[model samples]
Target: MEKSRVYFTDMRTTENSNLQKKLARLIRKAGIGNIDFEKKYVAIKIHFGEPGNLSYLRPNYAKTVADTVKDLDGKPFLTDCNTLYVGGRKNALDHIDTAYLNGFSPFSTGCHVIIADGLKGTDEVLVPVSGGKYVKEAKIGRAVMDADVFISLTHFKGHEITGFGGALKNIGMGCGSRAGKMEMHSAGKPYVIQEQCVGCRVCAKSCAHDAISFTDKKANINHSLCAGCGRCIGVCHRDAIKPADDESFDILNQKVAEYTKAVVDKRPCFHISLVVDVSPQCDCHSGNDAAIVPDVGMFASFDPVALDVACADAVNAQPPIQNSQLKEHWNESGDHFHKVGPNTNWKVGIAHAVELGIGTTEYELIRV
Candidate 1:
């Protein structure tokens, strides 16, 4: 396979070019403008940062990307699907509120923020996954699947489950609707946490499949009737409903790749990952840990897989921070992500993406 080209630019800022300008320069150098952006509805997929998680990309960076898209005559909208987890981003209203609270308002990003899934997180489009082993059909957010062009602006960091949350995770897991995320993360249906149930019946009201029942003012779930849409999990105020996190770490990674292919397939796609704030887990957490490694550069590519691999390679080459998790496991594995997450081999998703013909693992890193 021919090597895909990945572009890089360091964090160093000169008096002339700030980090934002450098980011614009880097993407342009990587050929982001080569796509036909004129009057197209472009979806810029990004994480708006779970409230209290300070490590996610700033809204300023989003502005630069959005402005660039506008300069190319594209109608850009910043977007991310509602989360499957009960948090500040579980529904469209909460998701948009969290975005604005985290500084992603239309006034800041120079674009609108759309919760890709609708109000309850049930609005989804099931797209067939080509060459998929785990996922035959991927349930992506309707707004995400409706884009004329797709772009992922990812925050590259270590994940406890995926080894690393790079471009593949951003484009795949980040774009999935609530149920789509459940399909990737769980192998079984949701069950009520009996201890946490408050007899509120909110879970029952949210269950369209008649899965919830109450006994002694506590909730119970009928798995036979459950579709595992994960709506009840998000609706319960007490966090009573919980999905079984039974999927193997490696299988979860493969499913993410399959979903990624479902979203980016047959579309003009571009990926840019910022390897800063290299946190030790997903930004889905209400908080983030210290950086595992010093800030690395920005990277961009047309191939999501190659872009992730290139970002991983760059991170592994850097020295670990003294106070973070990577420092303790530095001697265990040569790969930085693996050192942080023992079970999650990030390579699994990259290899699976290659097998699914999404992109090549081989890449040429051209420093900007």
Candidate 2:
């Protein structure tokens, strides 16, 4: 197979060109303009950083991307689906509020922020995966599927579950609706955390299958009757419902690639990933650890798989920062992500994507 082109630009800034400007140049050079953006609704998928995580991509980078889209006559909106985990961004209202709090307001990014999933994280569009083994039908957020074009703006970092949360993780897991997220992460059933349950029956009211029952003021889920819609999780205010992360790490990676296919298939898609702050975990966390390695740079590509491989290789090439997490877990010859996160392997997802025809892992990194 022929190699895909992955463009790279270092973080160095001259007196005239800043990081944001460099980002704009990077994407443009990577061929973002090749897509037809005229009068189209473009979804720029992004993470608006959980309330206190300071390592997420800044609004300045988002603004540059949005402005570039506007320059091409496209209507761009900064968007992300609701997360499965309970946090500041669990619902649309809270998600937007958190985005604004994290400085992703319209005034800052030259675009509007839209929570792809509706208020309770139930609004979804059922998208079929053409060559899926793990996910036959993916439940993606409605607004994300509603967009005329798709673009992923990812903050590349070490992830406990996926080894590294790169383009695939950002698009697949990020685009999944509440139930979709449950399916990717687990077997699609949620069990109540008995200690946190007040037996208020708020979850019982939301269950479509009458699977939830209370005994001794603690709610329990009947897996036999449960349909796994995950609505009960959305309605629980006491943080009682916890979605199971039972899928093996490698299986989770493959499911993420399949869901990513559901999101980008039949749509004009592009991706950009920033390898900075190299956080030890996903930005979904309220807190973040120190950089595992020095910032590599920015990468952009039309092929999500190639983009991820290029970014991973760039990080591997950089020496680990002293006293960093990667430094602590340093293995002499293993891949950097595997050294940092022992259980998860990002290559599993990239390889699955290759089998699914997403893109080739073989890439040519062209420096910009």
Candidate 3:
């Protein structure tokens, strides 16, 4: 396999130089300017932190990226699909409100925010994954697929399900519409956890299939009538509804890679990951835990798989932060992400991505 070049820059900076300026330089050095952005719709996929999650990438970083695109005459807009889980970012209106609440406004990021999946998370495009093993047709957000160019501005962090969330996670899982997310999470359907159920009837209101019923102030989902659209998961404020995490981690990882293939295929794409925070869970959560490891740096590459592999390797090379969640089982197997979320295997996704011809895991780390 040919080695892809993954650019890196440490967090160390003087008053004369800051992280934002370094990010711009790193992306340019990694050849972001090579893509013609003139008058083109460029979708910069990013996670607008779940309401209470403080570890998400700052809007300032997003502004730096958007400004860089605009410098090359690209029409840039920050975007992300409505998450499958109920949270501040479930629908387009609420998603935008949460983005603004987190300080990601046009005034802040120098670009507009577009919720890729529309009002109900139903606005999607069925994209054919050419070499997909798990998914033949990936349902991606229409706004994301419509862009002439795609860029992933990912906040690298650990995930309860995927081990770690990186460039691939941001593009594959993050770009998936609500129905698309359901397909990736399970081969079956979603269910309501009655204990957490507030019986506000919010979930029932979101379900188009009339699968939800309330009895004794608790909501129940009838599996036979449920379409598994996953809108119910988005509407429940109490987090009572959830998709089945029944698929094995390996299969789940492969599906993520296949979903990524559907996203970036035949489009000019660039990936950037900031490996700070090093949280022990996905940013989709309401709150983030302590840092598992010290901040590594910023990484950028045209290859999503290579970028992920490089970031993971860098994280593994660092010592765990004392007293953080990682200290509980640090270096049990020399992989922090796995140790943090033992049920997950982050490597499976990258390997599958390589197999899908998304990019090579073998990368040459180039410091700029």
Candidate 4:
């Protein structure tokens, strides 16, 4: 197999060219110029940081990408699906509000911010893929499916479950609607813990299928009626609702891979990952921890698997910050991320992505 090309640009900036200008030039040199961007609806998928997280990519970089798309005659929009957990981004209205607060507004990025899933998280398009482990079809956001092209502007960082969240993670789990996330993470059975139920009926109000009801001052979940959408779980104030544990960690990884494949199966896709911040956990948390390493820089590729592999390798090659979470496992050599996050096998996602014919793990880094 030919070595996939992964373009890289470090933190150094010339006096005339700022980071944003450098980003635009790097992307052009990375092969985005090959695509016919005229009049196409391009979905620039990204994680608009949860309200309190300060380590997310600034809106300036997004603006550069959006402006470049418009220059090529493509209509671009910054997009992301709602989260499954209760937070500022559980629905379109609140999610958009959070994005704006985090500086991802149309005024900031030169494009509209569309929550891919509609008003509630239920609005989605079911896309089919053969031989999937946990899902036969992925319930992706309608806007994301409607777009003519897909581009991911991802903040590459460590993830608690997947080891690292990169290009594939941004599109796969990030594109999934609330219910779709439930399907990917577990067996799709949500239950109410009686001990934590306060009989507030919040969960009942959020259930679209009338699957939740109150009996004896406690919430009861009717598994037959529940589509496993997980809205009820997020709405419950007492931490009552929970997803069942039928799938193991390994199964979860395979399921995520299948869903990811379903998302970009036949799409004209491009990916860019910012390997800065280098947080120890995902941005889904309300707050970001201290970075575990110095800012590495930016990477882009036509191949998502190769992009992620190169980003991980670049991060591991850096010296772990002395007082950060990476210090916990500095003695382990060769694979620093694995040693720091033993429970997560990020390689599994990349390897599975390759097996699904997404892209190859072997790559050649082209420094810009």
Model 4 Cα lDDT, one tens digit per residue, 1-368: 68899999998888887889888988999999788888899999999999899888899999999998998899999999988777889888989999999999899899999999887776788888666756788888989999998899999998888888888889889998877888877785898889988899988888789998889989998989987777776555565777775666566676777777877888788889999998988898999888888899999999988999999999998988888888867875767667667888887777778877888999999998
Model 1 residue 7 lDDT score = 95
Please tell me which predicted candidate would have the highest TM-score against the true structure: 2
Of the two candidates 3 and 4, the one with more favorable lDDT, higher being better, is: 3
State the displacement of the C-alpha of residue 196, model 1, in Å, after optimal TM-score superposition: 4.0
* lDDT for each residue of candidate 3 in 1-368, tens digit (9 for 90 to 100): 88999999999999899999999999999999999999999999999999999999999999999999999999999999997766798889989999999999999999999999898687889999988998999989999999999999999999998999999999999999988998898978888787898779988887788999999999988999997677777556777788886788889889999999999998899999999999999998999899999999999999999999999999999888998888989654678887888889988888889889999988999998
TM-score of each: 0.95, 0.96, 0.90, 0.92
Clashing pairs in 3: none
- Model 3 Cα shift for residue 272 (angstroms): 0.3
Error of 4 at 279 (Å): 0.5
Candidates 1 and 4 compared by lDDT, better number: 1
lDDT of candidates 1 onward, in order: 0.91, 0.92, 0.92, 0.86
Worst window of 10 by summed lDDT in candidate 2 = 231-240
Model 1 TM: 0.95
Task: For candidate 1, write residues 223-250 as lDDT tens digits.
Answer: 8999887878766677677778889999
| Segments in model 1 whose C-alpha atoms lie over 4 Å from true places | 198-209, 234-238
TM-score result, candidate 3? 0.90
Worst 10 residues of 4 by lDDT: 231-240
